[model samples]
Target: MTISRRSLIAVAAAGSGLLALPLVARADGTLDEVKKRGTLRVGVTQAPPWYSKDPKTGQWSSGLGVFMGKAMAQSLGVKFEPVEVSWGNAIAALQGNKIDLMFVLDATAERKQAVDFPATALLWYSLAVLARDDLPVKTWEDLNKPGVRLSCAQATTVDSFLTKHTPKADIQRFPGNVEAIAAFQSGRVDAVGMFHPPLLAARQKLGKGKLVVPTPAESVPSSVAARKGDTAFVAWIDKAVGEYYRSGQTQKWYEQSLADFGLDPKTVPPIIKEMIT
Candidate 1:
């Protein structure tokens, strides 16, 4: 199933919450605070290919977010400091000033109530599945049969999506991506479900599987999160991230992260929508 540029762009345009907006110049004080503090605190968690902590060094070593955060900090002439925060608490961290910003957070309507997100999208990730090579799937409906088994992290967006769309399938919910992917690797499930970026690494590591974004493709643009009402900071982040996307730097960073994870970039799906085919 090859993705045409027109189709991918249409899928991307289906969502409005995280897409870039008109850059209104504002002087929100968060930028000044970060400058005064001499460090830009970025919220991070152990989500590979996006955010990860090195076991040996106990540092936020490599990932797309790490690269972007460091670049943003450097551009501001400050240090990049990664503060530990779970996806659940990232909003709280921004609200309470525990961190100055968080990268790669989706700008959902629910999340918009708590924190301000930049108008510019940090990157795009789509709901995709890594299915056994034998299972021919062209769409989500193709996997909605009673005998098919799909695995995903419990209580995640992926699980929720699978549950809603493929209710007849044997949807096995595991504790996390590792367990979900393990189920597929062990031949207990026909496929492992997650956003495309994480599944890319899994596919490379497993050395087999077909990665496909089902028809009626669902894609979301993720963005940087700042404190609510921090218009200036958000605008600044928006401009910087927009530049990254426009100049193709975001793809470079993502490719580097995949390489760092020991995956060949050619074997994985790209984060950029236009590069999907």
Candidate 2:
């Protein structure tokens, strides 16, 4: 799976036809193909409580993302292979055939063009503004005020959304969420726009930070992604996700993962059980 520049350009030109090629096969069955091959390679970020490495065990253990991946692997009878990827590289890694799936990604219309999303909506996330408590910022509208600096991850859906919705705000790009948060904490940026949980977790750790008064103006559904033409695998994922949601394990995983991260389980939205089932 060595994707060269020329090959990428060629694939881009062919587009749908290129995507239809079978990338991997299941061994014992359509599912075990991944297991017999050794691991279900997953693309994830270093965001703690979402997808990060564990210091004590020298293994990866994060939030619902890893939990979902493990569940999928187990249901499919495969081994889990968590690949640590930067926010910027995650999508590219998927496109370049470096990994089998991405556990977390906003299912924006634009992204749907490149990847296939399973029927289940993994989570719903709100874009939040995090700023110093002393700042005059109070709402999403305040973020549009003159001279306000905001930071978001490069090439992320959030960046695109902010650019379209809040064109007045100066947007800075960070390689990943951690650096963006670091910049905001150091006062290098006036505000940081990111998903609710991690930002809320940061606020709790810092004590006395002002989360913009009003909630996110827009909410986006997130989902697991596989290569565009992996129909059988994608169908299996849809069925597995459906069964997981139906069995109530999905909600349980969410509650336990949030609790493990010291986040309030109440903050998690009700699982959209209907979509998966």
- Top model number, lDDT: 1
Per-residue accuracy of model 2 over 1-277 as CA lDDT, tens digit each: 5546764554455433334222333234434457667778888776655675677997777666788888777766678888877765555566656778887676656556667889876665666767877677645666776688888888887788778766898888899888888788888888787766568677667654566523334555678887766788888877877777678777787777667766666643344434221
Q: Candidate 2, residue 157: CA error in Å?
A: 9.4
State the C-alpha lDDT per candidate.
Answer: 0.83, 0.68
Compared with the true structure, the alpha-carbon lDDT of candidate 1 equals 0.83
lDDT tens digits, residue span 1-277, model 1: 3546764454335344322221223354878888888899999998878887889999889999999999999999999999998887776667557888898888877667556888777888888899999998889999999999999999998988999999999999999999999999999999988989778768867888888888767778888888777777888999999999989999999889888887777756677766654
lDDT of 2 at 121: 69
Q: What is the Cα-based TM-score of model 1?
A: 0.74
- Those runs of model 1 whose alpha carbons end farther than 4 Å from true positions after fitting are 1-28, 134-183, 197-208, 214-216
